[model samples]
Target: MEETRSQVDWLTRAVEALPDEMTFDAMQQLILSMVFLRQVSDVPEGEAQGRPTWEELVGQVAGKPDLVHQPVQRALRAWSGSYGKFRIDLDNEAVLGQMRSDSRVVDRALRDLIALLDRAGRAGAKGDLYDQCLARFSEDRVGGDYYTPRDVVRTMVGLMAPAPGDEVYDPACGSAGLLTEAARYVETHGGRPADRTGPVLRLFGQDINARTRSIAAMNLILHGLEDTLPRDIGTDNSLLHGSDAGEKYSVVLANPPFSMRMPLTDAGFVFWRYGPPPKSKADLAWVQHVLGALKADGRAAILLPNGAAFRGGAERRIRAGLLYDDVVAAVIQLPSGLFSHTRVPACLWVFSKSKRAHAATRVLFINAQDTGVQVSRGRRTLTGADAERIASTFNSWSKHDAADVPGWCRTVALEEVEAADFDLQPARYVAPVAAETAPGEDERRVRELTEELYEHFAEASRLEHELRDVLGT
Candidate 1:
């Protein structure tokens, strides 16, 4: 506990010391250097481990037993040379002046420090220490941006319920969060954590960004999956390399980037069979990729933008093909602003390769757009209760009872789906419950007109305020 607390304090200090204009890479280097300084030092006998003096530790590494106050000078010089930068005397005011003039030197030093620490971490020297360093990195860098919250990850994993012997994969594994959650689920279900090896050996991921791949590897290691057998496979530019084809998985979970465009050639010709998706939207292509990667008994849960459900043209054809296969099991509509980066409402498309007794020819539609609570201004999240409600709804659907909760969830037949031009938008089919009737139509019309007039008055007032501000009133 002392070591953990010390490491945390060191990380906090290092991050705090970084320049405000520091690039992400530079911040990474600074954090890595601090981690190394905290972990890779010799301990004196009979000394308490809590809060060892940095000066004493640096002096021991430099072999200058008598130069306690001068340890920073030697440490600076040693780190400079290791990072491929010119050495400087920390105690020399003139040298420090010269060092501050060259920005390239600082960048090089930072890069070297990070590279050295990354190499050491991957070399099996101190796995737990390395993971703590990575946790700090994730906290500082990712925070709540572009990555799912940890609680949401846990909820998704619970709903998926990957068994110890199940093969799990995430095609767009951002930071490998889903993979780690799946591993945790296996352990909590009475399976030995080490059993995450052979069955977990089937873990795979692909990302288009190199830095994200590194983050994924670090995340997996931090989650006690460092020793899992068959090793996790991850690669950057995976789609471009065409490496994920012909591979299948027992379970897949992903939140792919929304509405991004990809060339048909880049996705390979095989996706064309589902009918070519529009060039400007690659949502259907991603759907096809997930479908192709699923084994005969596989299941998938994918997050998609609102456009994927009711879009016309090629996307409609792809939707039709999926329905034809009876692979779609459920569609859960999520609230807008649930993602940190975008305000576009999203949905979860759940698919199963083989139809269970309750899932045959029936699609469970959940209108959860109003389910989550607000986490920040204009941002919302599904609490544990909300997730449980949705999961229970799904569980009920899987048990063959048509869950017919008005305005919340319902089971749609394939015939109705075909009648709607294969549109999968949840709101189109599920009707909301009725409220008590008003006294008369004329009274209701007067009330509606009064509300419209108030809206116009409010808009006029807002415009007047804006004009006054612009005129410096």
Candidate 2:
């Protein structure tokens, strides 16, 4: 854990130094170059004798005249000397040069670099070089508003408890953070890293953005997900351009892009389980896609806008279908502004094909809006403790005879939801408590005094205006 933290720190620093305008693909290339340079610098002296300094190597292929190659060169020399017996050869130079010069070369380099780093990480290397590499790249490129926060990912992973044999997926995966987190969860939960085989071979994801698909693939590889390689990590524009009717997974977790639209074609017909989402609003469309992608026993967690809970029109029918089908498990209200890029209040919807020990007629609702701690001046986040509390609540509620905690959570019957127009908002069903009122006499006196002061101020302002008019006359 300490090593992971350190790697994350290094990644943060590396990304901080990179230009924010860099695309995910460009950032991946830069990371690949950095890793390759570091590896080359680690080679023995006899092998690396003819290798140029880092500056010279970068200068030779950077395709830019203004880039200061000298500093890089000096840094490389100093680093190599300090580390001892570091070397590079012609093949290494060619690889490094190609990675720096062309984007395609960088992609190949990134794949190879990640494969190497994965082997090293599993072998118990000093720092998580692969994690740092990806973190640095993510830091450089600003992700979308839908980018899932790491803490949220951790919490979701914990709640889902992805096992070794589970086939995890994210239909609208953004950089595959949830997928990577799921992989980590499996590894930590008594699953051998070497047991990369099994039904778990299925680590599926799809995204509308090609760049994001590539980034997601890279993210998966960085986290030691070797099963989803060059091909299985689908980047087909047609999939997003068309429709994917027959896809399923054991575990599905996603935070799809909020409030986006797509053309409705025959491909999109498969997502009409709850009726087609409005062309103006694709929120329900994504939900339908997730539900359709689930196996008979699959469990899914999706982050959705608050409106999905009670919106009228097509969305309402979708909500009705979800409740009627008994796939909805829990609805967790997240804190507002949890997303760094947007201020929309979000919620987590957990769905299951097969109800656990609890009745399918009941749904767990947790109001976690006020549970998170303020991380920045105006930004709040769920701490590990808060996440654990929420997860515990959900897990407990999954079992038979789960009790409700007043003001925090409740398990409402499906009939109650049906009566309430299938509204899933926690606040709607969770009874509100009456606040203690101040003494009546004191409150009345204060109100009277406040009204008197307002009258006096208005009169004074009127008199002042009159006096000014008189003076003008």
Give all TM-scores, in the order shown: 0.69, 0.69
Highest lDDT, which number?
2
Residues 394-463 of candidate 1 have per-residue lDDT tens digits of 7667665664889988899899999999989998877656566667976876886697668669968998
Candidate 1 Cα deviation (angstroms), residue 76:
14
True-vs-predicted CA distance for residue 401, candidate 2, Å: 3.9
- Clashes, model 2: 7
In model 1, the clashing pairs are none
**lDDT minimum window of 10 residues, candidate 2:** 82-91
Cα lDDT tens digits, model 2, 1-473, are 22345435544544444444555555555564455455444445466666654334443434433433333434344443212111221122332343345444444433343334334433333224644554444434445432577778877877788886677777777767787777777777777533635534346666767545544554454455655432345544322332233556788888877777756554635446778777777777777777777789988898888988988998889899888889999998888756656567888899888997566678999888777777554457788888888888887777664778887888899999999998999888665454566769778858866976686699689989999999995
Per-model lDDT: 0.63, 0.64
